[model samples]
Target: MDDLRRIDLNLLLTLHALLAEQHVTRAARRLHKSQPAISHALAQLREIFKDPLLTRRGAAMALTPRAQDLQRPLEAALNQLTSLLREGAFDPHQAIRHFRVAMSDYAAHLVLPTLVKRLRDQAPGIDIAVCQASREAMLAQLGDGEIDMALGVFPDTPSNIWVETLFQEHFISVADKRSLPLRGKLSLAQWLARPHVLVATRPDADNEIDSALAAQGLHRHIALVLPHWSASTKVLTDTDLILTVASRTLDPVLHGQELMQFTPPFKLPRFPFQQAWHIRRDSDPAHHWFRSTVMDCSRTSPQSGEKQAVSR
Candidate 1:
């Protein structure tokens, strides 16, 4: 008996539309259900709660006190449920969709241009909004459903977010051609001694170079800090101002200019850069397309030198 009564969930949805509109005809249109169906649902709700859910004043029907109490929360719950059902199975090729992706300025330096091209080629009508930020806030926004995806080296975040490895890259340094004092390659020592710019601004960072420097019991001096890798790269004019970056992404941005690549002075662990999205969107077709597309772009990015093999 309880199961039977509990299973008629449609009544709740109908009740939601009825209490909100306060008119049988309007609620029917809103629910795509007939006026008689709404009237029947109102009766069922009255029986369930033992209260008239709505009352009439002239032609306008006002919600009863009980209905008013239940209105907003009920509407919010229904809206969330509807959003859940409608979230997935979005087709990229035909659907006009815009998705927001969060990434660091450094991460964007390696992947966005190619990702954009792929999106345009595969789904012309689709659009992307790239938001660059630190990993923590991005992950929080992802959990709260404010952000759709986050890109970069988010190696060990929580389990609720899905991380797809985009690439594992060998970090290196780049400098302009006219700027090179001497060189086919600069040694790790020379790399470390030069004025280097780090793309980290946050107070605490799991910085890749710190690990690299720690390995050799040495550290690079930070001459400047930029919010994005693009700015750092462009700032590496002809001077000896060296830019620490992933080797895989260096060549693409280096237009055969006087730029150079060198191994780091110390043995630092390479970072695995991945794309993350909330688990809720795991089955979403458009999100699936975006994930695969990012992986494809990262893997075939000739600019990154070696293709990063994706792992889950």
Candidate 2:
């Protein structure tokens, strides 16, 4: 521990560059140091580790077996340290990061396109991977770092997670403009009478519309059940099926189709669409940028209140 304390932190930086570049001159250029300085650091690192980290192979420098073993773990340690040290300032333009997000299809349709466009314009090197998972699975993934963030309606979140409401989305009924007589608002009786298409991705998932109907001892004639939002478009376009969907999901699902949207007759609770991440990532600069960008993109109204930041 005393020897560890005596070690210079800058040597770790130099070692990182040396291991990455493998060549003295290149490592010197990368570290903005003279060749002799990099050589000295490399010699010291060799003495400390008792291994010649880099070896000369004809004309090029090759990593020794010990250096090859150290590559991944050392890089990971340095990266974690860098992230810890640079918690508040993130330069998006030059940053290279892959962000994994867990979201439902509805949230993806509502948020990803706009988010992608903004990312392209601002942070070209950043990449995104979207995963479809249940609320429980998403929360687990967030905890395990399998996913960086989650965007959906997650109620009763655990204390270890942080959540920020992006918007409040209410259910709306959509139908082919030519097939349905949509005037202003849809009545519950009219909604029940029409052949309805239900978007149930999972069998056991509780739907707000179904819950609302069940409370009033009412049920709609479910003509079809689809696992995806895009599947409803073709069926709604050709048939007389009226599909109930989140208001934000309407525009993307009915991109070129002629669809009429109206408020549902009964008062269904407006669910909060939120972005959640583990509490561990609350102070991460890149994570903060991602949360802010998603919030900005998905906010329906300026009047939609922002929740206070909670850290555990």
Candidate 3:
């Protein structure tokens, strides 16, 4: 405590700039200080640390072992202090951050394009890294801080997770026009007669569609079980297999002449499409801004509403 009290905070900032740049002139330019000022701070830092923190190595300066040890902790401490000072103020236009998100291909297709476009226009410095994972893995990643957010149908989340409904999504069936001549709607008998393509992250387990069918004491033969919703619709082009998927995932199929869509013959209720994050991030300004931007992008879908939010 005595050693800490003896050190000046301003000198530590100067040391950070110097260590990051490794050159007096460069560090001065970075901190907007004169080269002499940085040199003076470097001298004081060396005295305080009782060592030459930076030593000349050929044409460039390199950090001494002691300086190298302090680099990461010093940077983290400064960042935490900065975050504390700006807790409630987040300027998207000036913020440079990278966010990791987890979602299925269906939800990515529904929201990413609009989300990216909006980011380009409003928050150019922000970048997004998306990963695809099963529901269980997504929730686990959220809890571990491996992912910043997740978008999908998440139910019965833990007390530390928060969910905001982006929209209500319903399923629709699609089949190759060449294979199934009928359009508009199919009777339950016709639907059961045709082979179906099931898109599920876990192929072994039953999905909502299968559960819905089983409730009525009926079942459809799943000829193909695949995880890619975006590519599953194309599989129907040359086969008799039918794919029942989220409505937005079939947007291209709706316009293409190769395939046709019809209402699901069973009573599969509309599920809430949602975005979830760890409660630890609930009050973070950057995270709050990003969640709001995602919610705005979700409005691009034709049928979006039922604004429900639950946090614990």
Top candidate on TM-score is: 3
Per-residue lDDT of candidate 3, residues 1-312 (tens digit): 998898999998888777656778977886789999889999999999998999999997888989877876776687687688887688999999999999988888888999999999999999999999888888888866689999988866864567888988788888887777555567889889999998878778657899888888988999988889878877787777888888888867343788888888788998888899865455467887999899989986555444333433
* lDDT score, candidate 2: 0.78
| Model 1 residue pairs with clashes | 176-258, 177-258, 177-259, 179-238, 188-265, 248-304
List candidate 3 segments past 4 Å from native.
1-88, 181-184, 253-255, 301-312
Q: State the TM-score for model 2.
A: 0.65
TM-scores of the models, in the given order? 0.62, 0.65, 0.68
Candidate 2 Cα outliers beyond 4 Å, as residue runs: 1-88, 182-186, 252-257, 303-312
TM-score of 1: 0.62
**Model 3, CA-based lDDT:** 0.82
lDDT of 1 by residue, 1-312 (tens): 875565377987778667645678877886788788888888888988889988988867877888877865675576577668877656667888788888876667667788888878778888888887777888778766677888877755754466766766777767776665565476766666788777775645668777757766887787887776666677777667877777655546463665766565556677677788765455456776777777777775543322222223
Give the count of colliding residue pairs in each prediction.
6, 0, 0
Q: What tens digits encode model 2's per-residue C-alpha lDDT throughout 1-312?
A: 888885688998788777656678877886789999999999899998899999999998888889877865775577678678886568899889999998878888778889999999999999999988878788878755588899877776754567888887788888887876646455678778889888866766777888889999998888788778766666777677888888767665473457777777887888888899865455467877888889888865774536543433
Backbone clashes (count) for model 2: 0
